[model samples]
Target chain A: MVERHEVRLSGSGGQGMLLAGIILAEAAILADKNAVQSQSYGPEARGGASRSEVVISNTDIDYPKVTQPEIFMALTQEAYNKYHHDLGPNALLVVDESLSLTDDLPEKSRVVRVPIIESATETLKRPIVANIVALGVLVGASSIVEHEFIEKAVLNRVPRGTEELNRRALDLGFQLAAGAVGGNK
Target chain B: MSPTVKLLQGNEACVEGALAAGVKFFAGYPITPSTEIAELLAERLPLVGGRFMQMEDEIASMAAVIGASLTGTKAMTATSGPGFSLKQENLGFAIFTEIPCVVVNVMRGGPSTGLPTSPAQGDVMQARWGTHGDHPVIAVYPASVPEAYELTIKAFNLSEKYRTPVIMLMDEVVGHMREKVELPDVPQIPIEERPRPTVSKENYLPYDNNQGDVPPLANFGDGYHFHVTGLTHDQTGFPTSAPAKAKVLYERLHRKIENNLDDILMWETKDMEDAEIGVLAYGSTARSAARAVSLAREQGIKAGLMRPITIWPFPEKLITQYASQLKSLVVAEMNLGQYVNEVERAAQGQVPIKRVLQANGELIRPDTILQAIMEVK
Candidate 1:
């Protein structure tokens, strides 16, 4: 029953994907699982491509970075194109509806297309918590980390006075992931 | 405050470790992969009543730490590759002056800002000899975020115990990696303070050798009039070019570490009780090497791992002893043949040395290291 899961969150530098990675790892730790999070970003503060990787295991994690990630999220078209080919077989590829994938993806893979950004702007009224929405969707689909721990980590990490907004955004993500899972069939 | 368990980045662990080690002063310049250490210290040091200053440059930061240490403050500074280069002169000065301070170099791709954000072990030899002349260094490397916390505390402890500069050599991979760490209770962990001079002011010879090799030091403005110079000095603490005095000073500096190898050396070995091939690794690469060793063993290839936690004192005795039982040695690192050279020297043609090197910022994969282990006869 001791299993290892690798997740990578890719997006632009300002999208808070790196924070999402941290939250994911923290959630895994809260659930009594071993976890590590690492990130790679370009020099630019906003427009540059950013990628954060989190690995959760029931035992000690040796290699922290995800190579062929089982759970990969690409919030931007650039991130999708750059990382689409590196998915492991039967992997879960999560992407925003804003990114159109023209290239062929690996066979037997599950692609969850969620309106993460759109939901953040329209429903949450705060586009800044889109990363939390993405986190909720990932956890909702995979169950690599529990929903309660992810929410706890979010509350611990988010800026003061924004807890309610972030929690709402996370719940919205969970709903979106549920809808995406239903629609994918 | 009760001990708390939290997920912390390697840099954050270092800040906490430095805090636990009784570090009251930190002077550093922000650099890639290592800037977070300074940033966290800026926020956390004040809460603990420690002072944190961002110096104008790496050199000034090094100089400031040395100045602060002279006043009996447990001071430290953190920097990356290029900044580590800039700190060499002051580092040498501290080595010559026998100042107790911790210098953190979170290694990045080097040469000249080679790859600021990428991880590299290009500073391994540099940590040993980046400074100009003959000196003894005690540099320790951590392979995990929690070890980053533990070894940082050890770095400060070693610096104070030996009265020398201790380098906490971290790479980008470990520096930036976040892991869940249980902080040790502060009251339970042992903290060391620098040895103080026992003699009265009139008899306080700053460079006095009448005591043991590590002479007790007195704070600069604490009722003691002492001269601290980079130049060679004698028992009176005055500059002297006398042949006998210079020889004694130089030999003692080397011997203090050389004679105490047992106290300074630390390493970790796995499944090596009866193995033909030994994989030698350190820092981030050690993780990969450990995996490779486990995989090789699973495949029925009798392989083992010898990882050095205390890197700079070289752990020659362990390498030599381990080499005696091995048919071949595989040295794996993020840099190209940095520590392997030391292994080659220690192995002394006793076994074939195979190097698994990756200097382009990316970590060496476990499969690649396992491939090397498989290829080894």
Candidate 2:
């Protein structure tokens, strides 16, 4: 059985959705699985909603984009509403609880409300790293890539000493992932 | 002089590679998506004693490239969609006369005046059949910055190797993206120049295949003064209506590429061994497809991606090999369905071939591909 998986992260541009996709893709590649990552935003750079998708496969991937995602992560109400109808029948969705989204979800789909923005602010004292918090939830949902690989990918991408803050955020993410996976005791 | 790689935009890399490949002449009209190629070349060529001129328009730019190439100098030109349309007639001339030159088409959206600043793979078939006629053309596409550099060098080699017009079908993303590209050392890149005939003016058959599939070209002032035209011709450089001679010349021109398919064909494959579903894409679109295949595999779906680095001549052999095991094949391109026909035809009746197409002047994103895969999933 081939392992084909996609993770889509949507939020306002500065929420680091694109960077999260890169980190995930890099982690998958570090795991030696075939991976592809891409992102986009509107004419606006900072405030406009941005989206990113990543694919990880045991074999070669044909279509690059995620037409339908099995797991979706949204950081803002606009992103949550934008991609609400795109969630597959059995897809898993992770969205910020603080964002007011009132849409009805598909029957086979499951929505997880996480305090991503609040959590990022509380732990790292910044709202920007909420993507990593959401990404932690994705790792909990789908073990597509190893968390250790993600840590190394983060270290490899960020500047020399920014690791301390990222490590704190990543440790919290590890806890979140464990929680999502039922504490895997 | 240095053995380093810099992640460069496709256009920047092409200019650097073109100059290093002994290209001393450049003439182009600046159009969106491809202007950086000319801009870089304009700045750098003069430093290397190369001639770089901005022509009045695309038609003149193409003509200037041909004119410079005929004089035994490695020459080139670049343009986007409408500029490519303007160069079609002369492109046919390059095919008929077998002039060795490279044309870089940094593809943008449209048939007429489409999205100028946007990216599109709409020119795949246009690069194949854009110039009206049954003549041979060599086309290559680069998915990333490094390949863009490597392939631009290869394009010059193919042009000189076969004495035909070679095209680099780079899109806006590759053309503009600036990354950390480690440029390779000069000695590492084995350069090949065109075979120039040593035979005197009296006995030179400009269309002769006996001198190899490509006859050694003699520059205009090389004491081998011979005529080159776009009409049907015989062995001598003169135009002729003789059917047998016309047939012979036509067959050889086509064979230079056909016979070298093994060497000319380039592609990349992902998870194809047991893939029930296959995606066939080229250029910028393939970047997304490569990721989607991996995602599909994680979800317990058997999928693989096939991206053609060489878009023309359509990698039929490669496609046929994967087509046998696939339940369905998808051809995703920027335009409506131009290249999808070739993919469908290559698959024969073996499986269902479909197109997940887009043309609203936007790059085909990863989400659209996930939707298509789930349809089959």
In candidate 2, residue B310 scores what lDDT? 82
Tens-digit lDDT track of model 2 for B1-377:
76563324578888878877889999999988898888988998889888999999988998989999998989999999899989999999998899999999998888777777678888888899889989878899988766787888889998898899999998876676443345765634677788888887888877776787889888877788688888888777789988888888889988889999998888998888889999877787887777677678888999889889987777899888987788888778888888888888888889888678998877787667767988875
Q: Over the stretch A1-185, how does candidate 1's per-residue lDDT look in tens digits? A: 65879899999889998899999998998888999998884474367678898999999887777888999998999888776777888888788988887547677788888899999999888899999999989989887778899999899999999999999999998898888884351
> Which candidate number has the best TM-score?
1
Worst 10 residues of 1 chain B by lDDT: B184-193
DockQ of each: 0.78, 0.13
Q: Please report, in order, the local distance difference test score of every candidate based on alpha carbons.
A: 0.89, 0.79
- Top candidate by lDDT: 1
Interface RMSD, all candidates in order, equals 1.0, 6.0
Task: Say which docking band candidate 1 falls in.
Answer: medium
Error of 2 at B51 (Å): 1.2
